[model samples]
Target chain A: MGLTKSEIFSTEQNQLAQLLKALAHPARIAILQELMKSNTCICGDLVEELGLAQATISQHLKELKNAGLIQGTIEGVSVCYCINPSTWEMLEKETSGFFSSFKPAINCC
Target chain B: MGLTKSEIFSTEQNQLAQLLKALAHPARIAILQELMKSNTCICGDLVEELGLAQATISQHLKELKNAGLIQGTIEGVSVCYCINPSTWEMLEKETSGFFSSFKPAINCC
Candidate 1:
């Protein structure tokens, strides 16, 4: 496979792409929704909540953790996960900034 | 490769995933940022602005257009593109709702 070539872009562009890519999957979105709804640490509860395979849920959780969007803590044999508020806030700011930048042009389609 | 299996998710989940997937690539992100900054119709300016191949930029624009994030109009020899404000607003609402749902859990990591 070819390299990402992410260096060709600006740092902000790369950062934004990374954040969005982390959010580009349905399983991850479901995991996040479950986390938000619970508003509490989730320890292996995603398997039941999402009705997805344990390995699939674990993989999604790993992606979220790697993205720094969520944090996990070991609890016995299970790991409890929760949103990283700071990262969430940062994501909000970045996404809001991106989406709110456009103003309807006088004669745009 | 396996099928996407998007049917297992809720409508909201699928919609959000589609939008995020459309935004996941750096080329698409760059195109959006360029369009936002322009705040005017753009006709093939992305190739120069992004320093990417014409076909690459065109493909990225196709994804953005397919996601309804941008609208294109045919000019004499090129298609002019601009952000679709309504769709952008929808995206903002959906993404904001998702991210803002999390109130730090009482005893989360």
Candidate 2:
């Protein structure tokens, strides 16, 4: 909440951290996994699937949408949500780069 | 700070989220990047490299080490830090599976 000192880091590092922060919560992770498993936009099923209150699920969904990780649209009286393809691409690329770039050859105490 | 509701999520989901959370800070990401760039156990260079105070750097290092992403071993008086290969493998495997499992074929709003 205070100063993040994000300016000192490279754009890539900041972006990577932001993306990871967006996906850091267990509820969010669960929601994402459920969406992946469903393989389609979900409408009101998350509450049932997650066994959480509708309000709780909505807050989680809002966070995911705000992060651009997921997109939502209103259909009739319900909103449908699914993964945002572009952000998913960014997430995959950044994570792959971060993990792959590290070599475990450092011999330390 | 409050209850995490971890009981409702799978172990993998909880763990993946935990790992991501540990890496969700810019300072932490920067630390990891510096360590990777150095390609060896780093001792005291992080304070210089990151331009962050020693206490700040030490806290970030603690978070990473606590998550098992990095390990610190005391050498004489100073502690040496490096990536933990086993945990890195877990991180790589989990992220790989999470990203690759998506079909991306779902067409929706």
Candidate 3:
């Protein structure tokens, strides 16, 4: 079958994979970097900054929002976006834990 | 076009995305965790451990190896796999930088 058997994995494993999937695209990474660099809600500036069409940017933003990595608010006629701090922190901690698990052993492989 | 315009992003951004893509699956995460838990080269035991078919485990292992997250060598009649420490460290540093960029600003929506 061509389906992901998510039930077999631990919750942390699944959650990490979900977060990584959301960050797997270069466009999404760029968008997150832009938001972090701005340090404020960005509204209508991503298209010019990323050199991607508005539609593409919107799609990537939707994925990010769905992943809880970002949050958007309606400000006047435009939607302003910013990184979700809690989700970012969770991602950082979980990812760090995953990386930290692999301590290089002496004379291994 | 449906292709990723990777040229638009910085090298670090693209590299991070590539590494994340390799890790964007629960099975892959589980495999990495198992390898870390073993603390030694795993050979032919992942299928039993993960409950997935041999082919599926092999495919995930291939992706991990391609991403430089794991290394394998032929030992006797089987291939043994272990974590690639340098790539894991690089991944740790880069992902840490990415997450560290998002400082929660006061009164920012």
- How does candidate 1 score on lDDT? 0.84
Best by TM-score: 3
* lDDT of candidate 2 over B13-52, digit per residue (tens): 8999999999999899888888888876886999999878
TM-score of chain A of each: 0.93, 0.89, 0.94
Docking class of 3: high
Clashes of each: 0, 0, 0
RMSD of each: 1.4, 1.5, 1.1
Clashes of 1: 0
Per-residue alpha-carbon lDDT of candidate 1 for residues B1-109, written as tens digits (9 for 90 to 100): 3556687899999899899989887778888878877776776888887777887778788889999999998888988899888889999999988887878866777
Q: How well is candidate 1 docked (DockQ)?
A: 0.78
In model 3, the runs with Cα more than 4 Å from the true position are: none
C-alpha lDDT score of every prediction, in listed order = 0.84, 0.87, 0.91
Which pairs clash (backbone N, Cα, C closer than 3 Å) in model 3?
none
Every candidate's fraction of true contacts kept comes to 0.80, 0.83, 0.91
Best by the DockQ measure: 3
TM-score of 1: 0.95
